[model samples]
Target: MDSRSVSSRLRELVKFLGTVQGDLSNVTGPPSLLAPSSVVEVGHAWAQRPAVFAAPALESDPEKRSLLVLRWFLTSLRSQLYVNGAPGVSIKKPLNAFLGELFFASWTDEEHKATTQLVAEQVSHHPPITAMHIADREHGIRADGYARVEMTFNGAVNIRQVGHAMVHIDRYDEDHLVPLPDVKIRGFLGGCMYPEITGTYQIMSSAGFVTEIYFSGEGMISGKRNSFQARIYRREDTKRREPLYEATGIWSKGWTVKDVRTGDVLEVYDVEAPENAPMPIDIAPLDEQDEWESRRAWAGVLAGMASGDMRIVLAEKTKIEQAQRQLRAQEAAEGRKWEPLLFRSQEGEDHAVFHELTEGTGWRLFNERTKGVWKVDESKVVGAQSPYRGELTPLG
Candidate 1:
């Protein structure tokens, strides 16, 4: 374009941004910030720390493997909450994902000759359930899970995760069920909102070991942010329950795990350490990606978000939503039910394993809540391309 036109566009962009900020300034209640990402991409954060996610598969001892799993889970919280690239102390709300929205990514560890592939899909839209599957073929480790997020306003944005992830180690024939924690977004009125992991959750394993983590938010008087205490124990020892290992620290920063009997530190995970940084995820180029791919599907919205143009952002978002409504209407009119191409309802032996892992806990697979017990249909996931290639829908 000519210089005059370019200058005019820049001026308009600045003016629009100022106007947005001005509108926020006049708000009388808690204001929400627009995050520069979509919720579908948030599922990718679980596998960002690929090294941690894959470590459990390499360990032989079931106890040590359980500890490694706990470490991996705690380390992923920062990435999950800050996926928008915002400062640690600032978290904004992301765009809700449309049903069937898919994301594909992989992390390659050349030194270890390991590749961890991740696939995330928005399986349910009414309650917003995101299903994720991460597989490390080289290590025989596979994780499949879904997150059903329920957001409510109680002075702050309180979120309760109503789903669990199951990690299976093919070598040991073991399964680990990891429950999710609740979250509270504080400081909205102050204009800087941040997420705090709250409440308690547990990880139950088929190998007879379990780990429970308790999260404590910063108190008004004295306490640290992201602080937590976790205990690993044997499942059978309920009466004289003595923890095998304990972990304590701020999850957003770092934590140390120690042997309960000897008090010897086993491992330390530092969130900010250079060696502990999350591996970058590799995604296909937008042109090479399928129409249903997360980045390709939301290209326009992403561009608007990147350029800080709320007008374009809202318009693109509304267009997609309207298209989705139309597609649902068509399905109802034709008496055809829409099904996920990559994931299917959990059946057969999968049900038994899930039941065993969550036998005594409150983390049962809520098939009804998530629409269905979703699992990756490995047969359908052939390659980097999306499984679906028919007519374009809302996601496309």
Candidate 2:
């Protein structure tokens, strides 16, 4: 893509992210990384009305105010990826290439910042909402000597995906770990909640490669409008380790990682990708899911590639390992195992019911209206009859 087009697209994203709000509840990995209550709470607020806080709001919600601060930081650091360019290190898709790893790397880290008066005018808007307030703390240099930066964490130190990375901090040694809720974290949390994102950049990354990927989606969450754009970029990394799988769905599944060029397909369990399913399932892995209750780490390896002085290395692909299986134990019943079988007899106009048997319940009926919850003794449900193998797929 040319500098003009890339800049136009990103500017739109910035505008859009500015509008929506989202909550990123730390679903896995560590509690210390983000305050449990706040992660979800704040993330939801940001995702829902992200734009409200982008521009100054005369009358703003308190929660929205805090989110505005966080957004500022993300926007700024994204600008830096491009600014940090040397001669051949051309910036391209400043945000995508620079922060790809932190968020979810799908391409080589390259510069994509455009150098133009209008681009500069657009970027010269605001500052990041974060900063290293303390001198020495959390891996800072020297016992008391620290090197703190005010760079864009282009990535959110908060927020967690439903089935991806982000786990409890307590798992890795509770004593040494400090929860994000502690006042220490809140006060120093990115520091300077005042101005967000270091004032916009007049410049961006210098050189980089962009992949041919595009994504567009719209939905309603909790009765609010939602949308997203997935930008993918990749450069020939003969050195970088090829992914275990080709991300045929990357364009649709947000930013993702894969070893499309490698000989191995990373598989920790025996499973099959169910037709039209978001993820594959395996009954075997479910048994060991509890061990990773609080945390589970994936194997992240560096694929060797050369980019200038820094050896071109693919970012680590670490995700919160989750066990997805039908729980034999019923959520309602104490110790009984629920079966996955469904039985029905013709009644009325072919009325049918779906049962999600768990450990305790015996043939519990599902309520379609109640989101398939088997809480009640039985609930009247509709649309449970199979269409006799005749299903209408998405419209072309």
Mind sharing the TM-score for model 2? 0.16
Which regions of candidate 2 fall more than 4 Å away from where they truly are? 23-159, 164-389
**Model 2 clash number:** 75
Clashes of 1: 0
Residue 148, model 1: lDDT of 80
Q: Which residue segments of model 1 deviate by more than 4 Å?
A: 1-32, 85-88, 347-350, 383-387
Highest lDDT against the true fold, candidate: 1
Pick the TM-score winner: 1
Which lDDT value does model 2 have at 227? 15
Give one digit per residue, the lDDT tens place, for model 2 in 1-396: 475644554454334434444421112212111111211012111112222222213213322222222222223221222222221232221111100001100111112211110000000001111101111112111100001112222332222111100111111210110011100001122221111111111100011111221212222243111111212222233245232232222111122233344534332211122321211111224234222111111111112211221112123212111112112122235664222111121221222211111112232222221122211011211232322113311110
Give the distance in Å from residue 138's predicted Cα in candidate 1 to where it truly belongs: 0.8
lDDT for model 2, please.
0.19
